[model samples]
Target: MRNFDQWLSEMRPSINEYNFYVNFEKVYANVDSMKVELNILNSLVGSKDIEQDFREILKRYPETLRCIPTLLAVRQHEIYAQDEEGAFLYDFSRMNYSVEQYIAFMKKTGLLSLIGEHIINNLVDYCLGIETGLDSNARKNRGGHQMERLVEVYLKKAGLEYYKEMYLTQIEQTWGVDLSAISAEGTSTKRWDFVVKTDQRIYLIETNFYSSGGSKLNETSRSYKMIAEEAKSIPDTEFVWITDGGGWKSARRNLHETFDVLEHLYNIADLERGIFNSIFV
Candidate 1:
């Protein structure tokens, strides 16, 4: 059995790749889709009578209104605003309101001054920067994917035949393995992150990386503990949990509970030591 303290010592702070921070391709695509409208709105920059000019622009290209929400770092088409007067839900998707109402919204939101006072030189460049900032919110999702990708690299190096995101039913059907012991006799809908098929056994794998600690870490540990217990009853099946990260440091008690019973629990350090070759066979 692997010592829990020794395994915990190998947890990584993060498994982020260079592309994990910001997906520039998605940012570029978003900006490209709105490029024409943003360029049209550029005419409002440093206008003499900005309100009249904005109204004229709206008449010519009403579609430019769709790009207005992004200026405020908002992704949705509908934005709700209220004053002492009343509340109104402004629709950026189409001209659902009068020109005067949208003008009021622009003035109240300070978008009119932002454009007319030359606060930003170009709308296209400003939107690109905005999209980049917005893309950072996707880092959590990218972090999980990065861990899976890293595990896949080692799996390939070990020459294992594996399928990703396979459901329990599919695994049983494809490999002729009986997983009902873990699947609650076909009632449980469990999906393995990677399912490796070897001559002796089917490995049901789960992979994740967490940089920060929260209740989620504890919950994950407990859930995996239950899974580890349940998996033992299934013949010709092995459960492998490949996890790492400093977040586990804070939740080590719960993690140790799972680690005590999960024989195939491993981290990045174990993978470096060729755990796959020794165990997968």
Candidate 2:
């Protein structure tokens, strides 16, 4: 058995890959989808008569209205507000309110000033920048995927055929593992990150990476520990957890508890040492 200190020492400080920060491909796709709408709204830029110009543009291109909230960095089409004047829900989807009401909304919300005063030159370019800013919000999800992608690389390198996001039903039908202990009488919607078949055995894998400490790490540690025990009950099947990141340092006690019972748990450092070769062999 590995000592707690020794196991903690093996935890990685970071598993951040190059694409961990911003998924530019997804950002580009988002921006591309809104390109036509943003271009149509460009008519409002630097318009001395923003109200008249905006109404004219909307008459020709109703879809442009849906792109308005995003100019202010909002993801939704409907904006709600209660001001000194009155309460209103501005639906930019197709201008649910009158043009005058929208003009009032624009002026009150400072969007008219933003465009009429030439604060920005082109809505197309400006929205591209806004879309970039909005894409930053996806960093958390992208960061979470780094560990999965990293594990996939090693899995591929080990030459093991695998399926991603394998469900309990699929595993039962394929291997006949009797997952009743893990699922609710074999009717649960449980799924695993990856499932591999090799040399008369099936491996169930779970993966996660954390860069910051949170209560989630503790919960994840406990939960995966339960999964590890459940997998142990089925013959010819094993559970493998691939987790890393300095965040575990703060939750070492919880991680240590899981580590004590789950020897198949590994980190980035373990992969670097060719652990997959031994395990997958």
Which structure among the candidates has the greatest TM-score? 1
- Give the lDDT of residue 33 in candidate 2: 84
Candidate 1, after superposition: displacement of residue 21 in Å? Answer: 1.7
lDDT of each: 0.91, 0.84
**lDDT for each residue of candidate 1 in 1-281, tens digit (9 for 90 to 100):** 57899889999898779888899999999999989999999988998788999999899999999999999999999999999979999999998899999999999999999989999999999999999999998887777689899999999999989999999989889988788877878998988889998889889999998888999999999988988998888887889999999999999999999998899899999999999999986
Q: Taking the tens digit of each residue's C-alpha lDDT, what string does model 2 give over 1-281?
A: 55767756777777766666666787678778888888777767788888889878767787877877987899988999778889999998767888788878878889889988899988877777887888888778777777888899999998888999999999999877788877868778888999988877888899888878999999999998998888788888888998888889999988988988997999888888888888863
Question: What lDDT is reached at residue 230 by model 2?
Answer: 83
Model 2 off-target regions past 4 Å?
A: 1-4, 32-40, 84-86
Model 1: lDDT to the true structure: 0.91
- The alpha-carbon RMSD values of the candidates against the true structure, listed in the order shown, are 1.8, 2.4
